[model samples]
Target: MQMPKRQTDDTVAQAAWLYYVGNLSQQEVSTQLGVSRFKVLRMLADAREQGLVRITVEHRTARALALADRLVTTFGLTEAQVAPVGESNTDDTLARNAVAILASGYLARIAASETPVTVGLGWGRTLSAMADNVTGVRNSALTFVSLMGSVTYASHTAPGDVCVRLAAQTGGRAILLPAPFVTDSAAACDGIMAQRLVREAMGVARSADHAFMSVGECREGSILFQSDIFSADQIQQLRDADVVGDCCGVFYRADGTVADIELNRSTPCVQPADMTRMDTVLLAGGLGKRAATLAVLRAGFVKKLLVDEGLAVALLAEAEKQGK
Candidate 1:
């Protein structure tokens, strides 16, 4: 019985490898693996069920590229990628994942280069999804630095965790900020920044080659409000002050100036000015994030953008409204 089971496992692996990795037809796989076509089909199904095969679909249409070009020219962006929305993709989660897949492909291509590189990371759900999709890169000297303070609880959207995951996926190292995303006071923030390790990691982040981040709106649906990082009152106060969106935990107004709030001083993330020097890519979508995305684009800090069709259309509409 044991021998029979072992033989079956070997046959399954061979059939799967030939069909999936080797790109052989089912008949070819059946013949090469010395199995019937029916057996090959069963083995392929078994491979999928056992998690031996994973498939990803990415749609890049000329229409999407044309939309990206318009965004680039209108906003002075170096590059943009707009994911086409399928008729069935009304759900926000599906749209976010689509943009993340494009972002993952871009990052993977960058990591494939032989040169040493440092990437700065900001925390959000879309950014976390990008880390999940990164594959087939092994950059021994690559480094990922968290550009924001840590979340109190461990989560995939936490800056530290996202940085660690990207480092692991790229076969490199992670540098995390030790302090909270926001301290209670400027003095407390100063105390944390005074630590040698925190200061060193910040220095490295300032010099990083690329910065990848997501924007958040200052409203009920914001991650800042939902994560309990900022109390409802605090978020309401920001909204009252015309804070439209935020990047790297720093709030900003619709006109793109940093919001004049004391909370800015307590944030342990990359400074807004330093962000201009790095090649910044902002990944965000959904109607909830439209205001935030527009604010970031207006600020002119980002060099690249990855967004979905719905968000892209909304952003352009907002821009036209502002122009008139």
Candidate 2:
């Protein structure tokens, strides 16, 4: 009788290894090893079942992870997490990923709570993109707050648009903050604040069970700068102050400390102290946004920050290389 044929040890090992390492797809393994795709899949399943393949996800951005730790230690954060910026993609994708991750974590926290309620939404394209990425039961009684009022013109979606989106995703009440982003007179802002509806919304914010926001920068196209709101002098003042970035209309100076600016002349929004109190999360990335990113960090607004590899590496290297 012919001797029984032993199983191909190398084939089994290769499939198992590739499944764990992410270097090869089932198709790739099948093509290389002359096995059917179905067989490869089966072998991978067997690998997992038989304990030959195990998976542990290390954070993709090791450098960012380390930097986040250092930042958390230096800044005393509640917690910090970082994601990798894909080598082949733009910074916006990386920023969105970080935002999604942070949002997901916060939503998880809120979901586990008893009272399903009140969430404050920070407006901006970056934030709206994040809201777009959010889905499924957020809260039974979710409330969205307009972190700030409206921008000047341009017809872009309002910041409260993020609130609306959040409400839809998590199934809760979204409180829209409706007042102009900036005003010609201080009285105008005071009058808006005096409105009973706006007051109630602000009160909801004060009792915010969860607050979601992105840092703002004063660049021409920034959420604040480009919203058709800021005037020439206001824009010029921001430039003069070397204000890099902000969160919830909060600006910061070049040394990574909060910079004094003139944005609050129009709207009374969340401050650094309130931010320090809440479960604030920040999302920022991109090679070009180094100044803004650094400004935000120094401003000390982010309790939890989400960042990507390109910007993280650039920020770390720039801070290290040039000592800015």
Candidate of highest TM-score: 1
lDDT of 1 by residue, 1-324 (tens): 699998888778888889988999999998887778998999999977764665555667787878888888878899999889752356789888888988888888788778888999998889988887777778988999989898888888988999999887788999987779988867888899999988998999989999999997777665677778875556666877889888997888888888877777778889868987888999986767887888777777889999988887777777878871
Q: Candidate 1: misplaced stretches above 4 Å?
A: 1-16, 24-59
* Tens digit per residue, CA lDDT, model 2, 135-239: 445567556777667565633246676777667767766676667767654566778888998888777776675567766666766656755566787677678
Clashing pairs in 2: 138-170, 142-172, 142-173, 143-173, 144-174, 144-175, 216-246, 256-298
Instruction: Give the whole-model CA lDDT for all candidates, comma-separated.
Output: 0.84, 0.65
Model 1 residue pairs with clashes: none
Provide the lDDT at 26 for model 1. Answer: 100
Cα error, residue 178 of model 2, in Å, equals 1.9
**What would you estimate as the lDDT of candidate 1?**
0.84
